[model samples]
Target: MRINADFTQRVAVHFDQTEWVASPAAGVERKMLDRIGDEVARATTIVRFAPGSAFAAHTHDGGEEYLVLDGVFQDETGDFPVGSYVRNPPTSSHTPSASQGATILVKLHQFAPNDRTTVRRSINGADYVPLFKDDHETVEMRSWPSGQVVPIDAHGGAEVFVIDGGFTEQGEEFARWDWLRLPPGTRTELRAGPDGARVWMKSGHLSGMV
Candidate 1:
């Protein structure tokens, strides 16, 4: 139940190389990247929903954040197509389903307990988009041009998920769906690959919990 739970270490994962493990819901499977507990746990994952698949209504006691990677995602709130970024803050509840199948990168039980902000948006075609920012964390989507070098300061840890193309950081290459987590105080530069790169990033949330 503890997968890459160490906050002080740097970790990287190639999304496509991971095994798909079935979730409690039928037709819904997940590739877990990090976890700290059991079924109801603090986790980060890439989930896929087969056509017509659905999950029962559930409340996010510690909040939920996700991005639609492919296909369409649906819930009582509305339908979200690929490139959609959503945040269902603490105490929100919803029954999610995918009528025509979908894939998403999701984070569960990782919000400040008192946070209640809700956000839903599409980042398709966006060169730079700031999704959310609070005292605890900052989330954003950014695109890098080919061969461009961008500096990053992980003041309180940082995570990057490659959406399209590729990039290299400290000699490590990251392609589509690849994920990288840098520990607090790390300062680095990411150089875009030949085709450039678009990525989703989160930072400042890992300040002191470790």
Candidate 2:
């Protein structure tokens, strides 16, 4: 039942190294990440839908976030191709399906209450702004040329997952599905080699724990 289930510790694992398990629904499966409860557990995962498959309607009581990995994802709202980043905040609901099938990175029941930021950005559409700084911290997405300058402010933690790249952070190499977490007030940098880089990152959840 546990693949990469290390909630109380800092850990990392490559995606392909983990096995996928069946869900209650047909044509759907998941590579487990983290879980705290049984059926209603808060978790992160890589979910896949087989061709012409669909899932029943569901409510995101604790919220849901996903990045389309391959093919296309579908719902009553519309279709999402690869590179789509989606956020369905708390209390949001939707029915998801796909015709040609798809794979996605999904995070469930993990969002700040009332955090309403919802978006889908094409990773290639915008340029990566290195040395990006704000009053709170400096933020930057990955780029094609590789090596990146990372900045961290204070009172926060971060998780690193390579969506697509040969990424290395703090000298630790990470291939797809490789995951890592840094404690609060910790800082790290990343780089990608010949293939460029894409990642799924979440932060600002440290505070007094730092």
Model 2 ranges with Cα > 4 A deviation: 1-8, 129-140, 147-155, 206-210
lDDT of 2 by residue, 1-210 (tens): 344454335567668788888888899998877666666667878899999888889888887878788989988778999877777878888889989999998878776666555555555465452322323322335554566545544246666667667677666788876677666666556667557666666665534233
Question: In lDDT terms, how accurate is model 1?
Answer: 0.95
Error of 2 at 25 (Å): 0.9
lDDT of 2 at 147: 61
- Cα lDDT for residue 171, candidate 1: 97
Which candidate's lDDT is highest?
Answer: 1
| Alpha carbon lDDT at 119, candidate 2 | 56
Q: What overall lDDT, based on C-alpha atoms, would model 2 receive against the true structure?
A: 0.69
lDDT string for model 1 (58-173, tens) is: 99999999999999999999999999999999999999999999999999999999998999998987799999999999999999999999999998999999999999998989
